[model samples]
Target: MSGSLLDLVKALPTDPSWGPPTTTETMLNGVPYAAFSKGDKLGRMADWTTEGKDREGRGGRQQYNQRYRDQIYGAGPALQTVFNIEGQNEENTFSLVDNSRTTIRTRGFGRGGGTVFRGRGQRGGPTQRGGRGTFQRVGGRGGQQGYDNRGGRGGRGGRRFGWKDYDKPQRNREASVQPKDSWKVVEEIDFSRLTKLNLETGDGEDIDDYGFLYYYDRSFDKQPGAPTSVKKLNVLERAAYNITTSNDPVIQELAERDEATIFATDNILSMLMCAPRSVYSWDLVITRHNNKIYIDKREGSSLDMVTVNENAADAPLEISEGNKDSINSPAQLMMEATHINNVFPLQTVIESDTAKREMPHEHPFYNASEETDPPASKAYKYRRFDLSLEADPEPLHLIVRTELDAVVKNNISGEDQFLTIKALNEFDNRAQGSGGALDWRTKLASQRGAVVATEMKNNSCKLARWTVQSILAKADLMKLGFVSRANPKTSNDHIILGVLGYKPREFAVQMNLNLNNGWAIVRTFVDMVMKEPDGKYVLVKDPNKPTIRLYNVPKDTFEEDEGDGIGMSVVGEDGEE
Candidate 1:
């Protein structure tokens, strides 16, 4: 506490990286002490001997208070009684020394005319032992009274701010209901209007065909009026501009009434372009059945991709152009022609009775070590989502599908194969209807709107993202198998189904024809291919009615098959060749 140690102070280095002084132990007068310094710079020193005495005094005072409780509240006994106390209390209070003082307590009108303190340890002189109000107790200070500096009956306790509030929070009151929060009001959208707009295809493909389904999210920016010109506009920019320029009264009214900020590179650009933001997108599923195509649509939000700070609405928004494929692939020009757009491969689906009846262990690819058995035998069928499961009796899917030419390559053969793929698309149906898996999501969009400023306590996207990712990761194209009949009007007409088992590639085999239903039952197997006379591997084709083409032998072999059993043949029943 003296300046005499000034000469002992070390000169500070000019290096800016070095910080304040640190403490170390040293001996002072044959007793341990704490010296805070950097090098020779003396900052502070505390004698261990004096520290122990200070601790003892605090313990003595606390003991005195407890022993004489109920006599004068915080007031303790005489100094002699304090020194006579025994061992320290179990819990330490970080008290250094025992100092006694008196505090004057004056009653003030609090809420409901209840008593409150005017000041703590103010306007009072020290008193002897056993005196009332000797130690000042901290509480609400005097401002206007009623615990919150309010005078009138209307005042409860200032205002009850949220935990996130920067101002002082008012004391809890039982009489008041919770305050209304404005941030809870999410932006409103008219989903129906969006559905009418022709969706933009990123790859410039004409998707405005008859069987295409379209969905629009209402969360996108909707500016009023038309732009003066149109240049340097993004995809969303162009669309928003067109919408604003529309003569439609509804569109004009929406544009004119918005009180929010409008930004653009030029007067010609659209509001969405000037202030870039993620727009609402949809998942489109196209189905082609019996040569006719059908489409289903569902709405999804891209708001999460645009991080908003609700705390500061006017703050510059941080945009994260997340994996565009997962958001809206068709809208991105590059993804339109890729196989990544298709989530399902219909051609690979196996359609055989054997698959339905046999076990996974019995399949040809059943390698217990590799676990690469066929999906059908393993019960790994593609998943289908049905909205009817929620309430509608009919099923619905949020899955999206697009057509692309996928390239298949063989590593060992160095052969590249290009195949047309009509499969599932990356964009999936999410936030469908209003219940079950999408319940929380619908509620969040309803409350938080399209832009969220802060992190929500309950994350609703986890489930939706999982659903989409699972469908993408687990879907694939598997080979198909089928069983068929060769001919009718004959007994013992047992014929092997389409393509024999994957193994044993010889052409010589027995045939059976059961045409009871005009076509025999077809049992399919994976890797079932045929080797023609020219040695080319090809899929087994369906047999034509009235005739069957046998391979790898002379034309007259069918007439003389009973000899070698290695050539083509056409025989009636009774095991005759």
Candidate 2:
């Protein structure tokens, strides 16, 4: 028998088809085949107890087998086709529901490391957990408390613990004027788009000048926040007017003569130009007649009111929004600020009929025969700016009614220098919406630069508007008064800290205010109105969004309100009511 086996082996080696199998013959029946290394460990072909053993934390054979499967076979495309089967099997249908908690390691302070064990129904995925009490679980129970990094219990709303300021109530301000059903939406513009526009206009030329200016009181320019410099803010009764574009007699006269294609007051124009920096809502009425556009504000519009910290991160809250402090409310603060601005300029000027600088024409809006009180120190200059482009067939022009508050004689040149006066009021630094302002009483003297910078940040919109107005009027100097409350709790009493003077153009450069961008904004709006037919339009900033909307309405839109005297108040020549 041994002799017969040796003969058969010798015969197999000699035969071509029966010798050791060639590399090309790698299939058995219809199954693909591949060679495996002898050192690789083989896993069980069928394990029905894996799910039960894995529940007891002893089995995860599939995961372990997969890790080595790639290492042993190299996981290349050529080998993958030879090893993997195409048809479905029992392994594909098998499913294991894992109820076991997961253990995750996080970088911990001092020690080997930290381990965070997740409960079965925890929502968040595996992530690092640090700090003493930082484990947070969600969606398990309704009122269960969780620990936060700040060592405080989480609220029922699932809010993470931190500073209590995160709990600030939402601000839901009402629109300046609600849209009526009869109004049709014309265009909607975002502030972001307005910021990119730029159109350079020439230094405006004075079309006509009216009213007179009182000489500024140099005493207020002393060291601000000093005990000697502080003065009580008094309520002065003077005839000041803030007439709209169409109502002004000079603008009407100019419009009749076809002086310019557009007309707006300095206040209304500045607001529209600085629309990108504003946070609060305001509306302007644009009446398009023939080919002219007139920008006007509503009678009792918030545009006339000076806002307190309107650009602050935590702006003054309304009383209806659960704010306990009524003095710090937005409405009360606006009223206080408006009162200060109205009376501040009046007080800062030396009121003498002889030492005043009278314009070419008499006071446009003030009437001594009809009024008992003397008119406030104000001068209106109707300036014409060229807004024409080279591509246009006709030159476009804009006439803006600009105002000056006081006049000062230049000591060097012996020439009269015009000035625009505005006041910045401080409520309370410790208040909720103080915008991280310094204590004006204590720091204004020592750190005036820091205080002014803080005010610039907190009141960017207000300051920008003032700067724009000062530049619009071509004032030689812009006077900013730092006024603070006599007591933090009292809104009625205030004291002037000091007055800081700045040249309008230089101040505009410092504030990074681009007049070209403002002109571009004006021209863009003018073009929009010019394209539409003769009608009444309203341009309104959205209350809760960074957007402005243009609406087309009937001619008698705000007429009823004006006739009834419901929401209209006459603003004086000093731009105050």
Candidate 3:
């Protein structure tokens, strides 16, 4: 029953857990999906949103987007990369660390508080006879002339009353979520235009082989020393063609109240790239419209369009042939094929001090998707990057610069930033571009030299070591069994890995501090994640990346909580033991 690495990875979450209290109000076919304001007809709560349908479409494969309620919007957690450093170079001999630590001082009991009694002598000044103060002598009845006081009518007095002690009301700390400036809009928007008359396309969602969900705006590229913005989600739209009668309660209420907080989500899908394989110059614009992005990809040469119409069959012509879209993709298409290559397991060039490390056909880093930090190494170089268009200010470009520097400096912390792996493949570093658009590919080629230099400097660092210790206590062994193996795969780099490039953009959220419209960028691209004898994630070159632990969450995910004692690397030779 000993815990396995695969066991922990298998416990990760694939999708996010979302529900109410934190969920946003939404509507699909007039049905409510989440809590929404009742005052605004459109539920315009500053950052709130709703969706619409494309009632102006001709037929299947048209650019028509029918609004629907997929799911209520929960405040999705911000995306981040965790950085961690591991201790290595434990010496030629095995350096075993004792798991048991001695606590100098135990933590538990403490002196409790006592009542400040003042009764009689201890509290209240000796209680007055009867109640508090029942009597107060009135000098002489009414001070009329001496004669008027025949015999002071027994002086009368006002009655006394008591009040209860009060204290201030307390506040619930967990319920206090402030407004967020960032939002993410994931669109499987697919476009493929055949001609001015014919079109064919599909949703990127169902397409398995290739698809992209990048931010139109560079908003999360805040790098080291650059201004960074907080990132968050912005859309809650679904296919209205599939919605039920009552929309999400919150969205319906907001829209009914004439209140809305929608912005343009610039996502456009068309058959512009449809001509059997020909490229089509396409344009589309989408504003944040009630949590969902109100796309305006309507043009003369376009197919269908989503408009503000309650009817699904007939609506205003939002898309036309020549309508210019504010956020449209330029006419371009790369070589593409209809068939996808078969999926196969990746083979690693396992390293060994003496014995070859064998993986149980388990994915690299336990999960091919999860990015666990590599320990420091004598060398380290990341050739490619996955730049976000969401980094605001400083430009996605600036963010890329500063962040890369921070990574080298081992300073991956604070806002919109997390440690992520560009490539899990220990493959050679000579591979070319992989995903995204022209800008991304170009950035990859441009930053290759710079990324290498940065990696080289760190890899050559004299101060670096990694120490990994896995053990089972007496109780743990009785229940979970013993640590059966000591397997670690190190990277080798004598072979050619994939190529890399860098392109930075703005933060996913707008940064108030940044004056630039977009974030700076840096990109790294490759045909594959290389696995050589030299690049096996040795601890010598790993820098200040955060430790992202694998939790037992039943989904493939990363937990911010640092465990496994990773990312605690030492620099130079004579460092901590």
Candidate 4:
């Protein structure tokens, strides 16, 4: 029997509705706010950051900060900005700035060969029988007299021993851990002070509180081409520059390590207006002692004081459990430590494009009869820079060291310098065409080293761009002598973006190079300084001054020019070679 009964009713059309706006936008902590899909906030906080205002100490601001504190703790979206020639004017798009690139792109496939995580012991099955039975006996004669030879029979054997009852030798297992001395004196180092302090003011005077020190007893001679009227810094201004640029001995030691192979590049040292809010260090170690108190080991390089015990080791002090997670050692504790080590407090901008571009070049015709050669694309620029104060450099330096080691092993040429532009170009080309699989040589660099490097380079670019956007930001720097009026009248006019007023100090910028395996060249002690203020640090100007200086002693002792002018150098054919 087939029976089908259905009640079908049609309803009238209704007006389109979004259903009460799935989430109503509340003012970010009581101030008018607008959240963009890109994770950027257009609100009072961003406005206050750009303009001059006291963000801390005030009741509402403090409460507002505490309420939305989670914003800074997570990895925020990658910072990106576009620099293009505006329709209004294409001629002066990148004026008063240096254009150069440093690139490192390596491709391969495989997981990184680092320590892996495994549970300490095996899962449960059956408990092994415990007794000193050196050897399992088969029958009644070999069995002990008092014990049951058969199943539950104390005397003569009713049955022989079974295979199920035998116990195998238990293997003793241990994990590969750092020697006790590595963490013996667990000290709680306070790294909170390591971050930029009193950053709001941006005045030279506020720098003293953060333990910024200079390289005393060392004289840095001004290069010959430096501007005539160098902005003679005030006492506090000089001190501030001294401290920020001051060389840290620990950083120096790390760079000089026998394993380290630095390749000095053109764009290693450059300046930015604002620093990233937080510096992360995965290598930081923390430990728990019998007292239940935690200890921390500061791993990355920042200009912070390190305390040591009388024994000359890091002095351990008590820390809160919250901080225990920032430590790196004791693999068992790694998962727990991730929480504290992952805070991002401020959105960091990192441009993915390394500005690695190709310039078209045609072979010059020596004879009239020769056919015109087609234009070829040649590698023009590549940059590798990162803003990580602590953890970033370790991976970067390590990658360079490994790359150099490979060149040495291959020994393509009799020279020590094996890393070359050709090899780097090949890497960049291969990386562009390949998917994201890291081989042994590139595994570590891919996961951390390259990422950190790119972030730093991108952030520096962002900071420079932001500096010009806000007059208040430039004003603060001007008050501190970082930005000066070119003619004292132009000070009220448009500001120059990259005119750095201060001479650069302690920057650990190094690169390794092997151009055609000629010589394994190591260029170290490179720092980026602004073009010496042509008659003091000027903000505004008639004709713009040179912006950047790529300061480094080349591997060749014979080269006369040590610091190349970034802005002065022209790019195309008729320009400086």
Write down the TM-score of every candidate. 0.17, 0.73, 0.15, 0.14
- lDDT against true structure, model 2: 0.80
Please write out the lDDT profile of model 1 over residues 199-239, one tens digit for every residue: 21111111111111111111111221112111111111000
> How many Å off is the CA of 454 in candidate 3?
20
Clashes of 2: 6
Give the candidates in order of TM-score, highest first: 2, 1, 3, 4
> What's the lDDT of the predicted structure labeled candidate 4?
0.20
TM-score of 1: 0.17
Ranked by lDDT, top first: 2, 1, 4, 3
The residue-by-residue lDDT of candidate 4 on 1-577, one tens digit each, is 1221111101212233632222234245654332223222444343244232233335565566555532422122221111121222556565666444434443211232122112233434343223333122223342432322232323333454434524522222221112232222211222232122321211111100111111111011122113432332111100001111102222233344432222221111111122111111112111112211111112221112111110111111123212232221122122211111111000011112242121232111112253243111111111122211243334222101000000111136443211111100001112211112223123322353452233234223322222221121112121001112233222121111111111111111211111111111111111111112111110110111212112122123212332321111112221111
Question: Tell me, what's the RMSD of every candidate?
Answer: 32.6, 13.5, 42.2, 39.0
Cα lDDT tens digits for candidate 3, 1-577: 2554234334444434542222232344554333322221442223224234224434442222232132223211110000011112224357658845454432211232111211132223443223322322223323211111222323222432223213322211221111122312221212121111221111111101111111112222223112232221111111111111112222334335533222111111111111111111223222322222222222221222111111111111112322133111011101000000000000111122343222222211112244343221111111111222344232111000000101111135422221111211111122111111122122323554443333322221100000000000000000000000011111111111232212111111111111111101001100011111111110010011111111111111112332331212222122111
Candidate 1: list runs displaced more than 4 Å: 1-60, 66-399, 402-577
Give the lDDT of residue 372 in candidate 1: 33
User: Candidate 1's error at 532, in angstroms?
Assistant: 59
Best by lDDT: 2
